[model samples]
Target: MPVEPDCIVVGGGLAGLACARELACRGRSVRLLEAAAASGGRVATDTVDGFRIDRGFQVYLDAYPEGRRQLDLDALKLGRFEPGALVAEGRRLRRVTDPWRRPLAAVRSLVDGTVGLGDALRVARLRGELLGRMEAGGIDPDRPVAADERTTRAALEARGFSTRFIARFFEPFFGGVFLERGLDTAETVFEFTFAMFALGSACLPAGGMAAIPRQLASGLPADVVEVGTPVAAVEPVATVERGAVRLADGQRRACRAVVVATDRRAAERLLPPGSLPATDAGVTRGDKGARMVAFAAERSPIGGPTLLVSADRAGPIDNLTVPSDVVAGYAPAGAALIYASVRPDWAGDDAAAAADVLRQARGWFGSHVEQWRPLATLRIGHALPDESPAARRWRPTGPRLAPGLFICGDHVTSGSINGALVGGHRAAAAVDAELASG
Candidate 1:
C-alpha cells in the first residue's frame, strides 16, 4: 500500500522544516522530505579534524521579527559577535564604534583621524539622512519603492566619503553582506541592513551555524521527518482528487496539501506544466550567489574574528571572520577557524584564489599568512537569497499546478533565515486555511 500523508512538506531546509514543525505542532501527520542526507541546506556546519568549520559566513540581523516570534532561540544556544568592528586600511588598523555602545565610542569614531574629517562628517550626515528618511515616512517598510537605488558605494559617496574610506571599510563590509560590493543593490536593502547592524550585533549559534535549522527541526516529531527523500514532481489534477506528489524512490504519496520549500529551480522542476504563472517574480534559477572557502587556523587572526572585508578593489576574498571569537566552541584549544568567501565573480582556480587570499591577508592583518594551511574550500552556490525590494509581494499564496502542492524557501520571501521561517509559517497557515475551507 502506498503511504499517504495528510500533508507532505518538500525540502528539509529551514523554510520546509519550519512549515513541518508548525503543522506537526498542530497535530497533523506531516512528512518532511529532504533530498540531502541531512537538513540545514545552505546553513550547515562540518566538523573537521578536531575543529568546527561553518560552510559559509552567516549572521542574524537584529533578531528578525519573524524568527523572534516563531523560532526557539534557547534551543539553538545562539551567541553574538564582538560589539565593534576593527577595520584595516593601509598599515593602520582602527575600530569602528558601534552605535549601541557608549556615546564616547561614537564620538571617538567621528573625531578619529583614520576616517578624516570629511569622511566622518559624511558618515554623520548619512546617518542623519537615514534617520530622517525612516521618520518622515519617506521609506515604507512594507512596500517596495522604485526610488530605492542606493547601493553601498553611492550612499557612501553621496555624503562625500573618500575612496579610502569606501575601499577599506564599506566595500569589504557590504561585499561580505551583499556578495557584489559594486552591485547597484537596492537602497532599502542597505538601509535595512544598516539598521540591523546598528540595532543588533553579529551572532552565531554555539554548536555552529547549523544549530539554527537543527533547532527548528528539533521542534518536529522524529517520526515525521523522512531524510534522503526526493520529491520528483507535483501535479495538479481535478477537484477532490486535486494534486499528487511523486518521490524519486518510486513511491507515490498522496497529500491533501504540499509545501514545495526547496530552491526555486528545484521547485520549478517538480511542478506540472503551466502550474506556475508567468511573472517577473518566480523562483530564481541561475548560479548560486558566490563561492566561499573555510579554513581552520592554529591561531586567531589580527582582528580576532571581527568580520573583515578585504580593502582590495579587485580582491577575490570578500569577507573574513574568526570563528573562535564569534562562537565559543568553533575552535579547539589554542586554535581558530576562519571562513572566507570568493565572490561568484572571483571564482576560478581554487589554488590560485587561495594563494591570492593568503597574500591579501598578509597585507590586511599586518602579519605573514603564507604559513596557514589550506582547508576545504566549500563551493557554496546560491549563497545569498534574492533580496531585491521589488520582489516583496512574491510570497506563495495560491495553489501550485499540482492540486495540493505549495512552495517555500528563500525565493518565497527575500532569502534570509527570517524570510525562510516566515515563508514556512505562511505555508503552514495556508494549509490550515485550506483544510478548514474544505
Candidate 2:
C-alpha cells in the first residue's frame, strides 16, 4: 500500500493548487483533491466552435502582488487591454483615456464633454493620492478597515466627484468589477483596485483565464493534484494526531493535516457547524451572480482592444469586449469574438438573454450587430463574494480552524485572484508551522 500523504488539500482551485504547491516546496508530501473534472473551480474556459470563451468576462491585473509572486506571467504571454474604456452615451461612444497614460485623448474627452473639467482634475488628483497610499502600504487586505471607512459611492462623493460623473463613468466601470452598480463595496477595496489598475496593465493570457490554474498545477508532481475526487467531509481521527477526509466514494484518506480550499458554499458544508463565524455562515446571500454572452462577428466593431461600458440604463448589457481584438488566439483566423456581460436577472432563458443582448448591441454597433452569431451564454451564479461594507466586516478569516484542520479561499482574504492565492499561501504557512511544532 502507498504511504499516507502528509497533507490532503480539498478543492483544486487556485487556493488549493497554491496550498499544495507551497507544501510540496516545503518538502511535505501533499495530495490535492478536486470535485470537478478540471482543476479551476470558478476560473475556467471552454472551447466553442474553435472560439476560446472564458467562463465569464475576467481580466488579470499584472500589479497584483500575490499573482506576481505565484504565477509565471512571462510564459503565459499576456495580452493587454487599452488603459481606458469607451463609454456608451446615447448612440455615440465616448473614448475616455487615462490622463497620465494618454494625455491627448484625455484632452479630447474634455473637449467633447465626455468628462467635465472639474471631474477631470479630480481624476488626476485621485490617481496621485491612490498611488501614494499604495506605496505607503495603505491597501493591505489582511487588515480590517476602520469603522469610519466609507463605501465606494460615499468615498467618491467625498472626493468631490460629481454625481453625473459617478453615474456615467464610475458606476458602469466599477459596477462591472464589483458585480454591483450601487458602488457599495468597501472604499478600501476600491482604493486597492484603483491603485492596481493605475500601476499595472489589465491583461489576458494567450490561452485564456484557465491557463492560470493550469500553469500552477503544472509545477506539482503528476499525482499531487487529483481532479474528479470529491471529498464528502473532513473528519478528525480519534486515535491519531492527524485528520481523515471521507471521500464521496466512501473511502477515507488519512493525512497529517487537511485544508479546505473550496468556495464559500462548499467550505461551509465540509467544515464543522461552529467553525465559521455567524457572518460567514450562509452562502446563498452575500454573493454576486453574472452572465457572459458571447457572439462571433465577421469583423471587429470597436477596432482596438478597449473595454466598452454602457452608461445608458436603457440597456441590459453592462460591459462588452472583443476578446479576439485583445488576443488573436481567442478566435479562429479572420473571425472576431465579442463578450458581453449582463446581470443574471436580465432574462428568463438563454435565448431571451441573447436576444436582449443583441438588441442592446445594435444600438452601440448599428444594424450590423444583428449579423453577429450567438455563440454561448455562460452564467456564473457565484462569480464573487459580496464586497459591500457589511460583507467586508466579515472578510479575512484566518486559515487555521483547528489543530489538524484549516480553511482558505477568497472569503478568507479579499475577493480576487490575488486574494485566493494569498489565502492559500497563508494556509500553507500555518500548516507548516503546526506540523513542525509537533
Q: Which is the leading candidate under lDDT? A: 2
Per-residue alpha-carbon lDDT of candidate 2 for residues 270-363, written as tens digits (9 for 90 to 100): 8767676667454224688888899999998889899998887776788999989998699999999999998544555766888888888888
lDDT of model number 1: 0.70
Question: Which TM-score value belongs to model 2?
Answer: 0.96
lDDT of each: 0.70, 0.87
Report the C-alpha lDDT of model 1 over 1-438, residue by residue, as the tens digit: 126667888899988898998888777778888999998888888898766777767887644667788766676676677665666554445777664464676677777765566776666677677667755756433333454555556766776778877776676777667766663445666775665566567788888888888888887877778888888977565534844678898777777788888887787688666655554645343434766666667677754546665665456667677777776888788777777777556746876877777766777764546557777776666676554443333434433334466777776655577767877887888787777677
In candidate 2, which residue pairs clash? Answer: none
Evaluate residue 348 in candidate 2 and report its C-alpha lDDT on the 0 to 100 scale: 54
lDDT at residue 380 of model 1 (Cα atoms): 67
